[model samples]
Target chain A: MNNNETTAASKASKPTHEHTHDHEHSHLDETELRVRALKSLLSEKGYLDPEALNVLIDTYQHQVGPQNGARVVARAWTDSTFKQWLLEDASAAIASLGFTGRQGEHMVVVENTSDVHNMVVCTLCSCYPWPVLGLPPSWYKSAPYRARAVSDPVGVLAEFGITLPTGKSISVWDSTAEVRYLVLPEQPANTEHLSEQQLGELVTRNSMIGTGLPDPASAVSQ
Target chain B: MTNNSAKSNLTATADVLRELPDIPRRDNEPVFDEPWQAEVFALSLSLHEQGVFTWTEWAHTLSSTIKEAQRDGDPDLGNTYYLHWLSALEQLIIDKNLGDAAQLNKLHKAWDTAARNTAHGLPITLP
Candidate 1:
């Protein structure tokens, strides 16, 4: 494979990748710098407090995220009593685990069965339960996702490489500021003997979003 | 603004929070693939907290920016949401007299040039 004698596809793909990456990277860098510049301006002008900025960043970065949601899902899979309690009153059940705050004041838990699969979306905006699930991925907030999820959920799921069984029913729940929804993905097979922690290890953020599935292979590999 | 007027204004801002959803985000860590998106998010929130602008005004600015982008033939894919956010932030800063448009433009150019010259995986410092 000589660099000068590359195939046409390879040659084209390389530049496209580089161009796209460069464009996006530069845009991101520009925004980051602008924010930094703005911070300096505000700080110098005495309009902003540095300590508050750190606290906000620290809270989002560490104190909140998907692991909290994973714990709740894992517990539901292992404890029938708790699962029933969760289905009846999610806010209380989640608060029992001590993950409650802004964006999670009202929560609705939808369970996935063999015949029915649950998916979550916010057609108008991104409304996620930040206290438990953490911040959302960039794709979740994209225009294509917001518009497509409600209109063609299966197709959208397929685009994420998730192919459901032909006869299975798909339900798309739209989240709003008043109520946030979480998808309780069906537990994978052959994990009956596993502990709650072990079950949680199998859950991915995408699985909870219904854009992905829990694989037994991941558990084995780890 | 008078104390009563300010109180009403703040209540209107609070009502906007109740009615509309701002800060489009998901439930995993690092909501953005790029670091700059988070920076923009934090900057807006920080400014709002410092009383530079109400969240309601920021939300309106961002929503209008997205709407304008759509009118201009944006395909409405989710990827451009943050671009609207950045645009709104810029406009708000200028409108509020918190930042100089000329200075921002200068810094943007400097950052772009610096980023282009820097190697991949290295920290980009504005010259």
Candidate 2:
């Protein structure tokens, strides 16, 4: 491709890929530098303890995320007794799994059954269960999704490529700061032999948020 | 401010968070995409703890910063959430007389110098 010369004298400049890569590399470095300076200022001022900051960052960076919620879903799918507990006292049931946190203090697990589908939205702001879901995706926080999810959940689910059974009702739960709702996505069919761990692998972050569903067993086995 | 008081008041900031204008968050903590995002989060909380500005002022600063960004055509697609947060923190510091633009500018320059002198793989100590 280099053999074909450009008419605008652009060949004199280095290849575009290399030029752009350097630009991005420096851009990242600039952001890194800014962070380092900010850290130095806070450290020098003695306002923030370095250890505490690391703990806070690590909590979100490593620990809290959708996988924890996946485990809860898997447990409920296989154990009817635990499922009853989860639906009734989600915070305690979830805490039993060692996913306890203030962000998940008052959780309510809404089951997705054959008769109905569930979705959650915070109409006023982004109130999400972080301990279970990590951060809300951009669309979840966007005004359109927040507004439309409540007004037209069926349409919103369609937008997400979900086509519910013709008569399956859709229910939208408006989340609040005091109570976060987690959807226990319907267990996929034909997975009777799969273990709980295997079932968890079928779950995606969106499934817990009710924006998506668990991958079908056959699709996941691939 | 004493260390003991700061520790006691950390949870209190969570309540103050409720007063801020619409912002994306998970749990009570602000949602962050990068380490710097979390850094800004902790920095603001720390500043609040140290009495750099009251939580009411923090709320006002963040709300106004967000409004300004919206007015300036920030599409509010959620990617630039932290940039507005950083702006709010800086604005509060300057407005409250805790720091000024000149000091922040110098901090950035010093960091740039430190970063330039450091080897590619090494940690850049502040200049």
Candidate 3:
């Protein structure tokens, strides 16, 4: 092999630690280490090889990520009975729409009644219900989210551009072994007669995550 | 998946496991009728295998629990946390012991298949 080719090959064959030495003393936390190891395994196994990376990227773009959280939104908007059922047992209720556990399986749907509003957090670890929702976004699992969601949930929601009314009591649900929760937000005003599909289109993932209210106009714009 | 590739991956993983710190044994443990602890132990290993966490991280986490327990005057090592995770999985696999094992094996095989397919520029679909 030529000198350049030899150098490239040598680089390719080098141990991971040798290349990672710069970050060795960086006090890599458990989460970081886990992410690194996962990436390393993926890369080494060619699951993250260059050509595979492209396909993976495409898959991520086309196949993965959140589907429209519209049905839940629509039910809240029009069908009061369906909304009640959703609040009672979200997993079974959502399954009716064929959206039962795609990613987040362990789910408990909480209602935002006139007196109380509900929010969710996986404080101990990111034990999300992936059966309904897809894999959690990076932000959901971040340390800031885990810490802040419990201590100052209102403030965190504010940061996400969501604000509750003064009289509304926000109840933060800590997802544990028995259940994972989704926030069944109140129906937004306007578009009362909109079709189920249209209402479903309006239910953004953010609303389900208790970060935002549904916006039919926004869905229409999209 | 090629046998060589699968073998190499297993070797790499085993090498990592070999480097892992020993899990300290506990004494006068709660004598449960079920093999709950073993199941939790297996789940932690499975999670580690699935790349949810690394050996070093798990080791450190367990170590911290041990340290905290020692400080709190609780003599028991923090193996219970892992034991709990395993028990959860075990309970999940109840009445389907063979099925659970098969599922684990399937996951391993899928990982290998994905790895091979990824090498060939094909997307690996996770089961």
Candidate 4:
């Protein structure tokens, strides 16, 4: 074998740490260790197809994330008819916009009014609608979040930088195996002149998750 | 026709997934809480799609891994389901001659070092 081929084979076969002595003090979290171990082994064997992986990741990150849900929210915010339809039948309304499949086959849209604020959680497991929301954030799946959301919705919201009105009653929805929820946050006061697209830009994943409120002032009008 | 069929499709998929462990798949949507969890899930699916392993084999291995964990005092809480999944994937890959333990252990250590040096929220680029 040629020198280059020898080097390549050895590089693939050898442990990377043996070549270096700099990591004397570092430690890995158990989950991180397992994930890396599998990923590396898969790559070494050519089983880790980067392109396929990217396609899956990009699909969630771009094509089927909060942005899709943002469009739904924006449409509902600007058009009363659409809003009514969404409230009445969210699955059909969302699917009509070409956002349907998998975790999003069933959906429920709950509106936040002046009197009642809505929050969502999955006490048993994180059951979120992936079609519109992509994936649930790590915090949503945490033990503290699952337990505390039911016991203290207001306090949990406060930790997420949300402070609802003192009089507004908080209604927490525990997402389960049968139903998924999407919160329709109240539109901010100054966004009346903004177009539907512009309004959609103002809606964030957290706001839709009911852990945050939209920052309309930051959504530059075009 | 499409709308009615779409609703039926939901029932179809939901019914099948209802039997899967760790997933409350009746009427509930699947929620992947972490990026790594999604990545691992996609890896398994892609592997299956490529005909590397049959669905039956994948399900059997995964269920056994979870069962083993339960035997070892794992609480069977929903959170650790994916951890067991990763374990099963590793074992299956090794058994199938797709990879070896020595290489995986090396990579694991390398990743630990690299991750330690990287700042929070930034992606870990293995060296």
Give me the TM-scores for chain A across all models, comma-separated: 0.78, 0.78, 0.66, 0.75
Question: Of the native A-B interface contacts, what share survives in model 4?
Answer: 0.25
By lDDT, the best candidate is 4
Docking class of 3: incorrect
TM-score of 4: 0.58
Point out where model 2 deviates above 4 Å.
Answer: A1-41, A102-105, A218-222, B1-35, B41-68, B88-127
Residue-level lDDT tens digits of model 4 in B1-127: 0110000111235444433323111213345657787788778767877777765577567767866876798656557767877888888888787878887888888888787787544677787
* Candidate order (lDDT): 4, 1, 2, 3
Error of 1 at A176 (Å): 2.3
Q: What is the TM-score of chain A in candidate 4?
A: 0.75
TM agreement with the true structure for every prediction: 0.65, 0.66, 0.49, 0.58
User: What local lDDT score does residue A141 receive in model 4, on the 0 to 100 scale?
Assistant: 57
Error of 2 at A192 (Å): 2.9
The residue-by-residue lDDT of candidate 2 on B1-127, one tens digit each, is: 0001001112234455443334232333345666788877667756766667765566567657766887798766567767777888777766876567777778888888765566544665764
Off by over 4 Å in 1: A1-47, A103-105, B1-35, B45-64, B75-79, B88-127
Query: Is 1 or 2 the stronger prediction by lDDT?
Result: 1
Give the alpha carbon lDDT tens digit for every residue of A1-222 in model 1: 234334433656565545434433323355566766665556556766767766767777777788898999999999999999888889999999998854324787889899888888766556677878887777786667766566566656766778887677777787765677888889998888788998888888878887778666766765
Candidate 3 lDDT by residue in tens digits, B1-127:
0001000111234454444323232332332223333223334445445555544454445444434544566433232343333323333332223234444444555555444444223444443
Clashing pairs in 2: none
